[model samples]
Target: MCHMTACSLLSYIAIAWMKMVPMQTIRSRVQFFKISALSLVFCVSVVFGNISLRFLPVSFNQAVGATTPFFTAVFAYLMTLEREAWLTCLTLVPVVAGVIIASGGEPSFNLFGFIMCISATAARALKTVLQGILLSSEGEKLNSMNLLLYMAPMAVVFLRPATLIMEENVVGITLALARDDIKIIWYLLFNSALAYFVNLTNFLVTKHTSALTLQVLGNAKGAVAVVVSILIFRNPVSVTGMLGYTLTVFGVILYSEAKKRSK
Candidate 1:
């Protein structure tokens, strides 16, 4: 996360240097409280997401994560008071049910890991809803790049203290590990570049579309994650798990269709 946020900040600075956008404009006068809140949400989503991987199989993790739209609707109403159509709301039923079934059926499920994944999912939803709320006003509105330009550093600030407290001697341990394997540095550099793009595109998507729409698109990505996890990692998945994921994805498709028809 440290590397990811730093890369995002530096990359935006490089964009400013290239005269693509003025540094001054990138440094928009967003409310301090809003940015801080956003950073905290971003940190929770990412930190808990990584933690979930340690205890759950990648396939099962994506299955649980696929229910983002369900949480998004809850947060949307709570934050923005923007209610979906009754039919659209109804479509979320299977989305919720599938995750419950999947969690029960997952052979590698850890109670703590499942909680972290659910929290991460909720944080992502909250972030999406909060992004829409905080950045919507004409006076405070920022384009995707400028918004990220502010968010990345704030995330770094919010995460550092927690990281130090939770992972004692992390700096020394990482240095020792790096000494044993210089390739670790290269891998970090590579992933840092990719993380910037992932974050950039997320903001871009949310900016162009509704927050729920962003969650809908995010839910669709789970199929690919599941496929790659099976192919590369050869993760064991039970029949119940596959059926549950199928039901979840099917429900998401129905929700998308309901959304389009409503529009």
Candidate 2:
């Protein structure tokens, strides 16, 4: 929670430093409400994502994360009334099935963690869809930096109450941790930087491409994470688990190709 708050704070400061969006314009009632809704969805995704990682191995988390494209496609169509090609929809079959197969073989899988991961994935998809819907218009559209400027402060506001309710003595504990190990502070600073950049790039990419395209790229990220995590963490991954992960990657590739040809 502290790390996420730092990330949100960093986002606001960086955007404010850049002067990407006028602070005054952010007060428009309708725009503020829409962006706030988007921020809430995004915060839910981030929170659940963190919770899932605490219980699930990174490899398993990424494997399940590979299902993002499936959810993205579903939400995109529902929200936009934009039907995809039949082949593209069909491709999601294996993408979803692969996760189920991987779940069965995941040694470290916790049911609660699995639920949280799925919720996170779904919320992420919803966020992407909502971003496109609410902010894609000529009148409302803001560039990536400006979008982050508006959304990040709202994320910080939304996260504050949750952090207080959940953390018990978060400030004291964090201060103690920082006091005990200066390295922890640096680690958090590093992660907060990564989070801010990750979000900015996600918005930039989504602005340039469709929501599904971002998730397709994320599919490759999941595959890479699986490989790197296995190498670094030496996770006890089963053959079935690897196969499921492989299947999910293949499905993402197929889905991407189908969408391209449809275009």
Candidate 3:
């Protein structure tokens, strides 16, 4: 949360110096409220997502996280009343199937971790759906960067109290971690920079495409991450799991083609 807020502040400074900040104004209280609410959801999702990782293997987490696209499609339809192509809907079948299959092969499962991961995944999808509605509504659209500039501060406001209540010796812990390894500071700075890019690109994509597309892309990203994990850890993969991952990639390709045809 601190990293996100820092990036937002840095973005604000960069835009201000560029003299482009004025163009990224919030037009109304309603819009401000909407952004704040979305940011709160984002905060919850991130908190739970990190917590879940402690109990679940990365592979299982990714498998569960792959359900975001399914939830996004459902929320987009229900919340935004956005109709998607039937083919696009059909394409998600294999995506979910593959993930479920892959998850079934997981060596361990914690009910708590599964629940938290699923909650995080659902909250993430809800965030995307809400963002799509908020950004696509009437009047001038908020600049992608500006939205982050505003939302990030609001997220920090919501996160601060929660952090104090839930975490122990936050400042001392951070200082201790940094003192133990100065490289940790550099890693954090690097992560913050990448996170800023992720937020900026996410907003841009959500503004241009439907939320479901972003969710689908997120699943593909998960698949890629899984492959990277296997390579990094030198873990042996089962044939069933490999086929499941392969099917997910194939489904993503099919979904992309269906989306183009729908357009």
Candidate 4:
């Protein structure tokens, strides 16, 4: 939960900063359409992703989360229609292996859960690549906050109905929104905020870093999230799981080093 809390806090700060920053005019309908469509896709991804979480174990979820890089790689390649080096392809091996290992053994192989996770991963990956492309093409015109301002309103539209039906009793929810529940509220708020930041950061990072490096570092998020989840939830930490997490982190470090050397 602390991991979630920290992520949430960072997200909130990002969102707040986005609000404070002035945005350029939505000059073209095409840009507006792209933002709306992409934001909606992201909203759907989050909804499905959240639902999948209920059926999947935390370890499984984290492992699936770690697959984002692979998905991102695939999406980026398809979008760009560019072939990457052999080392880039090889890097995915450790990432996949680490995820399988860290998932507390093999996943249960639930079709629905697996599908949801896969869809969520693909959606997120596509969104990242699209956002990167947008940022690259329109860097001066579209600031980070502009992306948030555009995305958030669309997210609210997508999330509001779901919140009403799935998370009904807003009054009760509001009542429980106390200091003790600060963590939960913070997490939700920050998660929403971070959703935007992650999109923005992906653009910046991909611009500055290699795709493989961005992906590898992104995979580490799962390892960090898992470790944090284990500590906070007092989960049983198995030897295999520890080994897997270690490998995942190591792989990320290697990928980062490779990027540095290449630069």
Candidate 2: tens digits of C-alpha lDDT, residues 1-263? 44456656765676567665654356368777888899999889988998998999999999898888888988987878877778988998898898989999888879999999999999999898878765576666666766776677778888888788867898898789999888987887788878778877888788788888888888888899999998999979988888898889889888888888988
Q: Give the TM-score of candidate 3.
A: 0.90
Between prediction 2 and prediction 3, the one with superior lDDT is 2
lDDT of 2 at 219: 86
> In candidate 2, which residue pairs get closer than 3 Å at backbone N, Cα or C atoms, i.e. clash?
none
Question: Compared to the true structure, candidate 2 yields what TM-score?
Answer: 0.88
Model 3: lDDT to the true structure: 0.82
Choose the strongest candidate by TM-score.
3
- Write down the worst ten-residue block by lDDT for model 3: 102-111
Best by lDDT: 2
Give the per-residue lDDT of model 1 (tens digit) for 149-216.
Answer: 77788888878887887799987888898999988888877888777877778877877778888887
Instruction: Name the TM-score of candidate 1.
Output: 0.89
Each model's lDDT = 0.82, 0.83, 0.82, 0.66
TM-score of each: 0.89, 0.88, 0.90, 0.75
Error of 4 at 26 (Å): 2.1
